[model samples]
Target: MAVLNEEQEMLRDMAREWAVNESPVTEFRKVRASGEPEAFNRDAYATMAQMGWAGIIVPEAHGGSDFGYMSAGLVFEELGKTLTASPLLATTIAASAIALGGSEEQKARWLPKLASGEAIATLAVDEGAAHDPAAIETSVSGGKISGKKTFVHEAHGADLFVVAAKDGLYLVENGAGVTLTTRKLTDQRSHADVTFDGAAADKLAGGGDSLLDDVLDRARVLTAAEMLGMAQQVFDVTLEYLKQRVQFNQVLASFQALQHRMADLFADLAQMRSAVEAGLQAVDSGFGVARAATIAKAEANRVLHTISNQGIQLHGGIGMTDEYDVGFYLKRARVLEASWGSSSFLKDRYASLGGY
Candidate 1:
């Protein structure tokens, strides 16, 4: 586990408590059933905003607490436990782009709103079936962006878009030439496909392609944090069930074979936690961030595959049913496993980062 400061620990505890009491998996089920047309409830998102979660990484000058990436990851870890659907991660990731690539004036104009949750932002980076930042076909001409972006996270009610174009990252406001089409993900969450038909845009003023990579590295780290939380939650539930489930005149947990499997999962979970914490710290410390993020994400995806499957199998058919929340965790894990980068894709990138 990552060692947190007093304030970060407080934030982590607050987020965990909030997810358990206010927005458990059952609450997520209610949101899915209500057909609210948005990915998350507005009231809940507002509550997060009120809690200062929206600006976990933004500098204090810009209405943020100046807490680093690890702090944000702490809260996200809790949110993943409940499968909470909010723009918090998407917005915070977008905020990183502005922090690294936006000019002083741009930061002055946008960071405060993002930190306050008065505006929601998303990074429109994926342009095709493959998740490649270098594969951006989007073009920027005449101060406008024109292309289609798929797999846009937290786009249901986004206020701004930090877009990846052929030239580099650009800022496009929501209106006029921008069109949003919501897609229902397999996880019962909302993702958007955005069409930028000559949407007026301004080029990011600070950094270049490397900055885009930096923003993505941050996203990958946060994604790993969420996956770690998922793996832990499912493992806990499965462990409890095994202890209670009786078969063949003995408790399931007492079976040596099953016990060995869980013991292996526990070991894998520990490794995944180490990778996630390393990624978070590297991002905050600016040391080997790219490598750390890729390794963490790849390891997390592997751990999730093992833990989720073992979870369902150990539950003895009840895990496959909708009445059980473990199934929801599996569904959510599948989506996240593919998001940012899959285990295989990240493995390749990690090697390439080493000039292999």
Candidate 2:
């Protein structure tokens, strides 16, 4: 685990409490059963905003504390443990696009609302089956954007969208001509296939072609934090199960083979933790951010896949059932593995950047 200062520790603890008490996996299961209209609980998200989680990385002048991305990562890591379904991740990334490249006027207009959680925001980057920003077919002409963007997280209830086009990023509000088609994922959360037809959009004041890469890099880092948390949860739960589950008149944990597998998982988890922390620090300090983010996301994808599968295998038949919460983490882990960028895709990107 990364060493956190007092404030970061407080943020993590508070998020942990909220995830346990207010938005546990059971809460998410209930939402899934109830077929809730929104992707996440609105009331709970408002409370998060009140706690300043949504604006953790925004500048104080824009209704934020300027706490930085590391603080945001700390909170997100906790939220990931329970698979808390809120717009916090998407919102933070959207807000950051503005902070990273938006002109002062754009920041003034959008930052405060985003910081307060008064606005729910998301990004629309993927245009095809693959998560390729370079494949963006979206076009901007005459101050109107027309294209289809898929894999749009939180689009079911997003108030704002920062859309990537061939030219640059554009702001498209939720209204006529901007249609959101929700595509349910394995995790029972809302992803979207959004189509914009002659929708009036404002080109992000200063955001250009490069802004997409910047935002995606930040999103990758935040998502890696979540994956790390999930990996930890799976490891902990599986380890506990091994201790209690008995076979051949001996606890599964007592088996030498199982212990060795767990030890390997522990080492992988440590590497994941280090990668994610380095990515956070790199983004926070604006140095080697792209390399750090790709490495983190790639390692997280690999580690999470190994751990989640191991968790299922070690838990025996019960791991495959819906009654088991461990299975839930596995489903979410699969979704997150392919999110933003897949493991293979990220590795290719890293290699292209001269990484061996």
What TM-score, computed on C-alpha atoms, does each candidate reach?
0.98, 0.97
Alpha carbon lDDT of residue 225, candidate 1?
A: 90
Expressed as tens digits, the lDDT of each residue in 97-209 for candidate 2 is 88987888889999999999899898889988778877988998998899999878889879999999888888889897898777878888878899999998877757555
**Scored by Cα lDDT, where does model 1 land?**
0.90
Candidate 2, residue 353: how far the Cα is off, in Å = 1.4
Q: What is the lDDT of residue 22 in candidate 1?
A: 96
What's the lDDT for all of these models?
A: 0.90, 0.90
C-alpha lDDT of residue 149 in model 2? 92
For candidate 2, report its TM-score.
Answer: 0.97
Task: Tell me how many residue pairs clash in candidate 1.
Answer: 0
Which ranges in model 2 have alpha carbons more than 4 Å from their true place?
Answer: 207-209
Which pairs, if any, clash in model 2? none
